[model samples]
Target: MNILNIDLYSILIAYIGIALILAKIMGSLFEKYRLPAVLGEILTGVFLGSSFISIFSPSLSWFYKDPEFHYPLEHIGHIGILLLLFISGLETDVRTLKKTGKVATISTVMGVITPFILGYIAGILMGYSNQTSMVLGALLTATSIGVTARTMMDLGVLSSDVGTASLSASVMDDFLGIIAIILAIGASSIISLAIVGVNMLLLIVLELMVGMLVIKYIMRAMEKIKTTKAILGMSFGLMLLFAAFSQMTVQAAIEGAFFAGIIIGTTAESKIINDDVKAIAYGFFIPMFFVYIGSLINLQVFTNMKAIILAVVIVIIAIVGKVIGRAVGAKMGGFNWKQSLQMGIGSIPRMEVALVSIMIAIKGGAVKGELADIFLAATMIFVTVTTLITPPLLKWSFKDEIQQNGG
Candidate 1:
């Protein structure tokens, strides 16, 4: 496997080079057609990986199947995932979140409750066991804030009123979704719920009190040491610290990254920090993350009749439950139909969180045999379908607003 006498490691370089070149090419094509560039990046994954290539081009199958080629690519993509959320947080307006906290909380609760109940009922109707039904319900409660955030960013609305509301509500969704998954797995007692509640309380206190104090201190320190490079180093280290703390002990790492961003965002060097971070994240990491997400799809699921049906049903319930539920909550909080629709459309995609719940169920013995396979297939499809639909819906919902604002 020597390429110009460079050994197999040169293969890694070639793989990354090809992926980046194809990603940018496809991303540009999608943008030209007035769609999110990420759609193209994901489609690039679908084309290059097993979904299409492994099946269609078995002769070239070694390219994707060789772990030597794929694993490192996947690892790079995972890092992209972290940076994407970190930047999202950096751009967040905490004050806007504070003003809409009650509404967002209400939206999160309704968002989780409806999908959970509907998914549970769907599972029961399909003759699945009680524990399986619980797992299904729990899986339904997840919201992939990253997916939604990417689409919103593509639309240039990532920090808009609806965007902030969606982000804040999704943070709550991820929290509740994780708790539901743990409960469904039957791994923890009621005490686990109490601990989660306390964690939530602590997160709020930390955000309002500790977060402010720390950011205030960081801002003052930055003013004294005024190099953009040093500020970036400190800010990035802080974001990673928060992300690690959240994942190891409390909330979702994405939420922690967002909070970390907020902290750095408050400082005068925010713009400089943002430009540098964007160069790194958007340039290399985030695109790989989207491609990695796309590559995970097993198109073989399309061959299973039961799995296809299950995917359709779960996806429908997922869409209706999140949209109608969140919309209802938004209306109650004083938003009109238009705004409610925008918020609902923005919050419907479920990715990593839902996958985690489904995986937990499989490992815990709640879903097994043919049922486990079907559930996994269905969940992957559900996430894909939901991810596909969000961008257009958001564009439709926000078209008037964007037009009125004059591009």
Candidate 2:
């Protein structure tokens, strides 16, 4: 191990706090610009990235720069992402979505498959081995449902047909993404009985079934409490418990949270949980996830023209490949050109999800730091670009509706 000179704990505290504050500023600034809050977070991260920060802090050391510092908050980010997913699932209108579910499902499936294939093709062309290319495809398949959910909510369209359809689509998108991960994780074909790889597929399905049963029974047992806080708090606590038990995969915890929220419904305290917890979540923890992602980019590698070009090329293909892939899919699913484009743009951000995959790949020894860095940088760039672009595109497409609603 390399001898560490800097105080990692202190540096983490300083960095996390400063990062949160800046994220808030960036979020607000984006909101002011009529952009998605997610856009602000990503741009804040990109703007305050380690590359830019290093110019002034040459004396500062890479402490959390190592993987260990990532663990604690990485876990927390998982929690945040879980909560984000659950809250989003809670807000989804299942009945309306079931009506258009066919379109949404088809669109979402195509979104993942096309991106994966395109990313894989890009990988092979870029000289990545088959395993590397497969992992890259898996990385591209990660969709940020959190971004679209929050955007829909802010636009007061969460209950709209478009919002409902998008939510349902993302549900399938996440599920398919999980399976893509399994395939990628097992690309080397060394499966353990510990259920680390293929077993994940089984467990994810089982977790959803168990979560539904548990939520159905437990919710009825509650008898509709006077306030949602107490009940939701209990449910949230339960979510944490199950999440701890399901360390087999972050996908387990994520799907666990979604089912927990879905069974809880959005009527009573789901809104309350979202309001109370989102402040801490979107405000602090989630930004730390993005910033940590940004910090992973080592500018020293940029001195290598090959690495820089590879990173940029991957980022470009990530965007173009997914957009083109999903656009046709959405169009086939009855979306107009604009909605199809929005769906494509909406599916683009891949921060926490890709990070989770990267961590898994690294641990499983399927990928290394350079490839991981390439994926991470590519993901961050994709996220930043899409988050900034999607909101306006959405707003423009829905402007007539927004105007009619007096919003």
Candidate 3:
């Protein structure tokens, strides 16, 4: 285990150890300043990542240079994201979502449509090809439920009316964003659209009917085992299985983890496993996921004038589109101005799905080499800016409520 000649396993072990320790330290520091711990976790990655190291300490860049190192870290981060979604699902109150369902649905529709149209038009105005413009629009349509859910939970508002609606709406946003991706990639045939629609319907049926019944009984049997470790292990395994199934069918594994959590939330075991699940998720996986996201951002993108301008335009349109669209929809659905604004802010952050859409566009040959690089750079900036801004804005938007409740 020579440090200089470290193998893959050794490198991975060292990386995880460093990541967890730094993440915990930064997360706590951010919390002390009343900022979201997620922001600190992400910043830790930025500081340790190639973006910083390549400029300040080129010798240290070798740690992330190997493809072997990159791929394993990415998969581990993916698991963190799935676990975050699973915990979000488990905490989701079905009754609250049901009460806010109409608002959520309406807001999600408007939220998706507005940003998509704006992004497409912005791309065209920026002189990108039609295909690239469609991809841009598709990117704007994403709402990162992981960021939203984590921030909401940190604020202790995850079960509130606005929180429930925002969470539900974010889920629908991701699904619709998938459809946008299909269109962007020139797969908008009737057959493709039908398949997506069917998948959505299937997810609904599975969550509400078949999946619920099956998981309920399984938990009941597991409960009979009478051991906390057994229950935790069973729950974690089911979450992974559900995530895999969901990825195979709907192309979104987090959705599967989410639906699984919702099902498990209804069981008596939910209470027993809640704290343990949080300990596992927050202690390791979730922070790593945020850090991985930060690492993906290459600050060098800002060096290109064209890319910087494009990112600025895209960021403005992305924020304005979501805020206006969701606010209008929320108002139409009977919310006050403040709550509508809160929903708008809640839906602003875009992460994994946006990046995926752009990659699909580039790899599918819709965007050419130089343009693809530009688009990717602009997208990374967009994701980073949107993510960094959301937590603070969302907390401020709910300020009056927090004060009223003495939170």
Top lDDT hit:
3
Who is ahead in TM-score, 1 or 2?
Answer: 2
By lDDT, the candidates rank as 3, 1, 2
**RMSD to the hidden true structure, all candidates:** 5.8, 6.2, 5.2
Tens digit of lDDT per residue, candidate 1, span 1-407?
Answer: 75567445676687567777899999999768655577688767777666577666677666566788777876777567667767766776666555657768887788888888898889889887666877888898978876678777877888887788888887667657866775566523346546755775577468656767778777668667856588788887888788677756653455567667767777666777789999998989887777766666567767989888888999999999989888888888767888888888877888767765665466457777778768877887788789878888888888886786676
Q: Candidate 3: lDDT over CA atoms?
A: 0.79
TM-score of each: 0.71, 0.72, 0.75
lDDT of 2 by residue, 237-296 (tens): 876666555545543555555556666663354555666566666666667765555555
Which pairs clash in model 3? none
- lDDT for predicted candidate 1 compared with the true structure: 0.75
How does each model score on lDDT?
Answer: 0.75, 0.65, 0.79
Top candidate, metric TM-score: 3
TM-score of 2: 0.72
Compared with the true structure, what per-residue lDDT tens digits does model 3 show for residues 1-407? 65587677787788778888998899899778655577688778777678777997888778788898898877878888778768878887777665548889898999998998899889889888676787788889978876777787878888888898887787667667766775666534346546665776677587669777787789888988966589899999999998787766765566678778888998877887899999998988888877876676677766889888988999999999999999999999888888899899999988767765665565457776667667877887788789879989988988877787788
TM-score, cand. 3 vs. native: 0.75
